[model samples]
Every structure is written in C-alpha cells, then in structure tokens.
Target: MGVFGALNAAVSGLSAQAFALENISGNIANAATVGYKRLDTSFSDLVGGGKGAQPGQIAGTVSANSRATNGLQGDLQQSQVDTYMGINGGGYFVVQGKAGEVDGRTIFSGNDLYTRRGDFEVDKEGRLVNGAGYYLMGQPIDPVTKNVSGSVPQIITIDNSVIPAVTTDRIRYEGNLPTTPQTSNQLGGGDELLDATLTKASTGAAPDAAAAGQTVGVDAINAADEVAFLNTSIAGEAITVYNSSGTPVNVQMRWAKTFEDNGTQPDTWSLYYLSDSAATGANPKWTKVSDAQFDSSAGNGGQMLVPANDAMTITGLAVDGEVVGDMTLDFGTGALTQFSDSNGSAKISKLTQNGYPSGDLAGISISEAGRLVASYSNGRTRELHEISLVSFSGEAWLERVDGGAFEVTPESGEPIAGAQGRIVGKRLESSNTDIADEFSKLIVTQQAYSANTRIVSSGDQMLQEAINMIR
Candidate 1:
C-alpha cells in the first residue's frame, strides 16, 4: 500500500505539472491575440487527513486549477480605423454573436456576452461587427433631443441611406456693423448720407408704415434706381438656406443706414435681402427683413439698444421665389456692434444657419464618450447610438468561451452598469499574456514533470524488489 501510495502521488504530480505546462503553452500561444486574458495554474495539496497531517504520513498528491487574469488591463495601440475602440479601465463591451442569416439579414444569437476586444468594423449588412464575428450592442439616440432613446441595449446597425433634409429654422448672425460704411454712394461724393426717396428711412412713428415696406428696388425699368440703391447700401455676406425638399437658395443681404439720432429719434438701420433675382419692370427686388435700433450716444457709439427684442423673425421669407418658412434671425446678446472697419463692410465673423441638404452617409466612428456618430456628405454629423458597457463583481470567475469572450457563471455576479472605464476611440487593446513569463513557467513545469517521472520509476523499482524478495 505504501509503494502504491507513493506511485499515486507521483502520478498526480506529473498530472499537475502537465496541467501547468498546458496553461503556459496556451498563454504563449495567445500572446499576440487582441484582448486575450492569460490563465495561470493554481496548485493545491489533496491530503487524506482533514485537520492536520498524521505522523509519518507522505506528502499529499497535487491538484491543479486555472486562475484568471481578467482584471489586468492591456496596452492600447492606436489604429487608423475609425471604428476601433479600447477600454481605459474596468469594463467590458456588451456584444452578441451572429447565429444565422434570414433573407439577407443577420440574426443574432440572443445571448449577451462580455468582451474586451474592440477591433470592430462595419459589415456589408451595416452591422458593426468585430473580427470574432460578434455584433456590438448599443442604444439608439433620438436625433431631435440628442438623447438615448432606450435603456436596453440592442445590436447596432449603421444606416447608409440618405439623411432627410432639415429646413432652415434659425440663422445665427454675429458681426460688427460698420459705424461709417463706405458705400458706393458715400465714396462717390454723395452730399446726403441717405436718399430718403430711394430708402425707407424711419419716420419716428411707433410703427412707421414706410419703414416696413419697399426698402430697395432693382427692377430693370428703374435700372438707374437699382444702381443708386446698390451704391447706397453696404453688401452683407451671402448665405445659402435649405427648403423643405432640400432645395438650396442663396440669400444676399444688404444693410442700409436709415436714420441717425437727431436728438428726437434713435439711430435706426434697415436690413434687406434680395428676394427676386429675375424680377424686371416695377417688381420688388430687395425686401425689408428687420429694423435694427442702435444707441449712437452710448459709450461705444453704436451699442445695440434693445436687449429683449433683439432677434427678428422673417415670416415666409422668399429668396428667388423659394418660400422659406418663418425663421428667426438670431443676433446673439451683445453680438452686434457698430465698430469701425477699415474696409467699411459688415465683418461677418460668423454667419451660419441650422439647415442642411439631404446627404448620404460618408463615414462612422466611435467617440471618446462611447457614442457611435455618423457623418454625412453634406458636412453634418449626427449621434446614432450610445455604446453599452458593463462590469461584473467577480470578473475573473467568468466562464471563458470562444473568441476570447466570457459568459456569466454562478460564481460571476450579474453585469451592472457604471463601470470605471472610459472608451478610447480608434484604438485596440493587446492581449495581456507575457511571453517571457510563460517561457519561465515552461522551464519550471518541464523540470517538475521530469522529477515526478523519476519518482514513479523509483516506486516501480521498489515494488519489483519486493516481489523478488517474496519469490
């Protein structure tokens, strides 16, 4: 029984070393794999006595198990691909595998798995899939409110279809209006600052009818008046606005100084836009948009006077016969001033509108905030999805599966939100396996296995000698 016991212990030692060697081999094999977590061998003695060792008892046999290194993070490598991502801290990307296809559409496995691998690319069916054939999951974002629409995560699909057109609802205008504009009329030695017959100068009434109508005209019949009108007004930067059906129309603006403060009335200016490019013979060419009131006696000489009523709404504004619905011309607070310019023009530093023509999807990328953003050919970007991340209390206890992913186990706690990790875009996480450490373990395991084999041989020889003595 002692010889057999010695042989049994030797065999168990050999088995334990073999198990450690297997783990080392696997670790070395996956050293270059992305997001691979290496397993370490853990040995335990399986003694016969539970409380304490008996007198003269032999060393117990060995049992081996695997230890996980899931909590250890890998180094991040930047990639040129826009969709690739990496985690900076503790979390896993929630992903699902592809089960099959039905009618040219991919069907998911319906099983939620966790992984650190982020080498993902957009597939032909518009699904964002990793190299391991797992689909990324996220929640759709509302385009209007710019918020996640759902709480549960679903497989993310990139829609390449043309984005619908958004009509112009607001135009942000910011610049300094010239205090003394160098209009053609002013440069050409005009004795009068403004020609009241041509321009609708404010008449000091609360709602002057003439100030609200026919600010300027460019009709062919009054071709000479058109030239005079152009000479009197200073040109403003032109901007393109989109209509409901994605039709673009150019809106050219002009600013005309209507009245200077004569101690009785405040200094006023009328803004007009080209309404008809092809109008001839007694037809309206330029239409009035807004009447800007300024405080000429203020410290800065042309600070805007009205704060509460600064913005002007252009109702049913038509440019070249394209009817654009009511849109607000937002002159931001303290944004408009009457500073002197060397060129004597409205230095429009920022003049942009909130409208875009229909466009096709140009590209997609992951953002640092874990948002899947899609950019369009029309120079517009929209938030499509919010990437989902989860963490487990016992992450190392997760069951390993194919493709370096993990499944929930009895020892591993359920996945929870609010991980301590942040998403890094355009980067990939390398495997955590170290080749040098594996090689060192390989040498020790080889030596241990060899020693166990010698013990087994000695035990066999002792048994043979006992048999010979009996004979």
Candidate 2:
C-alpha cells in the first residue's frame, strides 16, 4: 500500500481499537450495575477501486465498528425483584413531583417520567419514593377519616366486622317455692342459687337478713348438658333473687337471638325465671312482694333483649349500661353463655361472661401479573394493587436524569405498555453484565489495540523506507 494509504489504515485501526477498549472497560466497570447491557465490537472490510485491491482486503475506517446487541428480553418474566419488596412486575414505575418536591413533578398526572429500578420504600413523610428518593405515583383514597391529600402513601384498609357472642337458653324454676335447702342442676352451666340475703356491711338495715326469721341453709345447683338438662323438671327457666326487702336486686337473664340487624336490637322478647320464687304472706319475716310486682312493668323481675344470633341466654342489664353481679354479659359481640345444673335447670350464679378467641399475620408475596399481596393473621392474603411494567424499545434512547431515571426520547418510542417479563419476588435482578464475556471482549480489544500499534509501527517503517530513498 502507498505511504499515505498505510498511514490512514493505521490511524483508523488505532481509533477503532481505542473505542472498542473503552467500551469493554465500561462493561467491566458496570458489571455490578443493575440493568447494564453488554457491548460488542464489529469489523468489516473497506477497499478502494482497482478491483478493490482484492475483495477481502481492509482499509481506512471501514475495518471495524462496535455496538450492543439485543438480549431479547421484555417477555413476561417473573423474577423475584426485591428493589421494592412490594413490586411484582417488571415495569417502569412513574412518579410526579408534588409542587415544591421537584421541578414540580408528579408521576401519573404531573410531568410523567419512567424508571426500571423497583427498590421502593415509604419515607418519613409517608411518600412512596424509590431508592434514589424519587417519589412513586398513585391516586388518593379516603377510607377512615375521609381525608385526602395529594401526596400520600397507599395502604390497604382491612374490613373488620365485630359481632360478639352471647348467652342463650332459658332458666327454669318449676313448682311451688320450697323451704330453703333447694338443690337442683338443670341448666347449661352449673351454678348455685342463694335464696337468702345477708345484711350489707355498709348498711345495718334490710330489717336485718337473719332477724326476719329467715333461716339460712346451704343449697347448691350444678351444671348439666343440654340433653340431661331437658330431662330435669326445672330446666329452661331462669331464677331471680330479691333482697330481703322484696326488691328484685339481681337476676340471671336467659335467651339470646342469632340474627344480626347491623348493630341493632331485635323485636319481640320475653323473660322466664327457671326457679321463680315468691315470699308467702304467711311469713312475716321477709317482706312479701305483692302480685303487683310480677305483673307491673316496674316490678321485681329481670329484663333482657333477645339477640337473634344464638339461642343462649344474655343479660338484660347489658342492653342498658347497668350491668350487675359477678358475671359480665358481652352483648355487644352478641355471644351468649348461661349457668345450668347437670339436669338442665338454670343455675343463676355460675355464668362466665367474658372470653373470646382471636386470630396472626402471615407473610408477603408477589403475583405473576405484578400484584403485591400481604398475608394476614387470619390466613388471608389480600391484593393491594396490581403491579405495572413499562418498556421502551431502546433504553439508550432515554435521556439520563437526576433520579437514576430516564426522560423519554423520541427514539425510545413511548413505553410499550406490557407486563410479560418473569417477575421474581424477594429477589433482585443484578446488573446484566457477564464477567467472562467482558473479559473475553477485553482480551479481543486488547489484541486489536496491539495490532493497531503494530500497524502504526509498520506505517512508520514504510514512511521511512519511502522518504529515505536510500535505494
């Protein structure tokens, strides 16, 4: 080749090799960088006329070129992307600036932008921002307080309905009131009834319990199952005990309804005393409650609101806020529990009023189509929101921005809306560069660099030979 031609060849070789080396170094440096693509070098032949000096000969800058190849990605790939513990899809997340937050940017509605990195978290201000602090985009919802802010984080609201359990079943006390020593067990729960009243320590009055000629005796009542309780003569009826003054001081209510009316009481109800007792006028000791007390609205008897949820017995005072006795009826939840003798007779004293079973939070996972799900304590996982993925034909076409984000370029061709990539949850898609590939390209580029150096040397020798003209 002529001296000028040889020199031109050497110059082009050096330029190509330098460019290839630079690209190789860039690949190696970004080996750990996420979403980094690998680059490759290309070579071709160039020739002048004169039959092109042999078809295979190379010349000038036509020798080689370098570029990146397509990795054939962007299908529905479910990779465990961990940047955002909640992201379940491979899509570009959008963000908008809230007035002074950025240059006045917003995700969906504001100056919309695109991003691939999914590592996202909530900030102190409850902003759904990315790892680089770029805010993610979303709409507003007012669930509880019914307040909405332009820039608020998103959270799923759980629907917790509270319906309490109540006590059901009647308390039955049959036959004429007998003298003290009454022993019966004919109720759902085993409990003893106290026919006698004692003088309150605070009050020296009540005609004095022991002074009324009222003899005290130890009488007991026990719990019985539903079947055995049915067999008992005094079953299904509740009891009532008035103070020595004949005032209905305490009573064990029975019967619970199971039908719920959205936190409202049901219509139609009645109260039955399993062991109803009345003081005989023949006894001058305890004050006798006249028949008027039993039939009058304000007389000596217990009142109860029937719950439609369960047939068990509940307290009447609970419906009103005036609860009494050692037992506490939880009518708010609508659960019913009652005291009973072994023979099914309603025993007034032994009812348990409070105890409930509670349900654990499980774990977190992602869906194939990009859904963030949170497992609940009740073995339930709810779909928070569908994940969205954004893809552009050419990434380099994106304009580099401050947030490790990209500004759309005309060439990137508006993100193709799709979510067909394999999305792996709880995992991250590390940088795409392969060390072996980078090193191999580095070796090749290095050799090309050396060969270019040799061409420059050879050109210099040829120039010397032609210029010296010693021959």
What digit string (tens of lDDT, one per residue) describes model 1 on residues 43-92?
99987434654764556788999999999998999899999999999999
Candidate number with greatest TM-score: 1
Q: What is the lDDT of residue 355 in candidate 1?
A: 92
Could you give candidate 2's per-residue lDDT for residues 1-471 as a string of tens digits?
A: 666677777677777778778778876886664444456677665664454447645454546565543232222223444325322334556654444534443323356666554555545443456555566653333333333334433332223332222222232222211111113421334322322232122123333232133232211112222222222223223233322222232343332111111222211112322222231222112111101001112331222233333233333322112222222222232222231124423333333322222223344455554555555553344454444456677755666565446677897778675544544555443445678877887788788778867877887887788889976
List per-prediction Cα lDDT, in the order shown: 0.83, 0.42
TM-scores for all candidates: the values are 0.88, 0.48
Under the 3 Å rule for N, CA and C atoms, how many clashes does model 2 have? Answer: 95
Work out candidate 2's RMSD over C-alphas.
Answer: 14.6
